[model samples]
Target: MISLQSGELFDTTIKDLLIPADKVAHVQLGNNLEHALLVLTKTGYTAVPVLDPHFTLHGLISSTHILDSILGLERIEFERLETMKVEEVMNTNIPRLNLNDQVMTGLNLVIDHPFVCVENDEAVFEGIFTRRAVLKQLDRRIKNK
Candidate 1:
């Protein structure tokens, strides 16, 4: 069994477990709200990180947020949604982690959020620490043992 008697493996660096940004489908800050809805619909992802052209993590956009905004707008015109940008409705308070932070720093975050955004030392968005991905890694270790 891949047992860490003292739970020491949680100390593993997140860099070793992260779902690299390139492997994920992210939304751009300037992307239209309609585009956000489409991505969530197509990907079936509850939320997706919003990045700038330089891949800086700005916020997270979710289907719920898009739906809420549309309902609040009370407008049926698709053009309205097209005119609004992801930055306008994306959640800016989502949790963040350093690209090299220990996995322990991400465990608590995964308990609540679907994923935690990771950034490099330059504060550039690097990837996501997804709950499923983390669990999968742990499971793989156990199985291999």
Candidate 2:
């Protein structure tokens, strides 16, 4: 599995992970979960960032949410659930990670929370790091060492 020294891997912002700077999918505050699904489908991503009315970081709409909504486990309004905004269902209590955080620190956070939102001090959505990413990065480091 991937692993990293507590403070190794990242010497700068989480922006480094955005390295090749891929086009990350995002949903506006007024946008609904349906939009999130469209973005995920187009990008083939598991999650997308959620922005508030003023474009501030709100939370994230993940595939899990979609699955839950589909399974009828989520409190979606059935017929008009897709029309509901992300704030109505996205996990707003999510923990966020900073750019300067250590790889191990980030890993630990993900260990506790399957998905961690990587962001800046102002809470701008930078990226979403999953437990798999941490493990992959750690494995790369171990092989190199």
Candidate 1's displacement at residue 31, Å, is 1.1
TM-score of each: 0.88, 0.68
Error of 2 at 5 (Å): 7.9
* Cα error, candidate 2, residue 3 (Å): 10
What CA RMSD would candidate 2 show?
Answer: 4.5
> Where does candidate 1 stray beyond 4 Å?
1-8, 72-77
Per-residue lDDT of model 1, residues 1-145, tens digit only: 2244477568678787788888888999999998889999999898999999998889899988887777645565566687888999899998899977888889889999878999999879889898997778678777877
Pull out the clashing pairs in model 1. none
lDDT of all predictions: 0.84, 0.66
TM-score of 1: 0.88
TM-score, candidate 2, is 0.68
Error of 1 at 134 (Å): 2.1
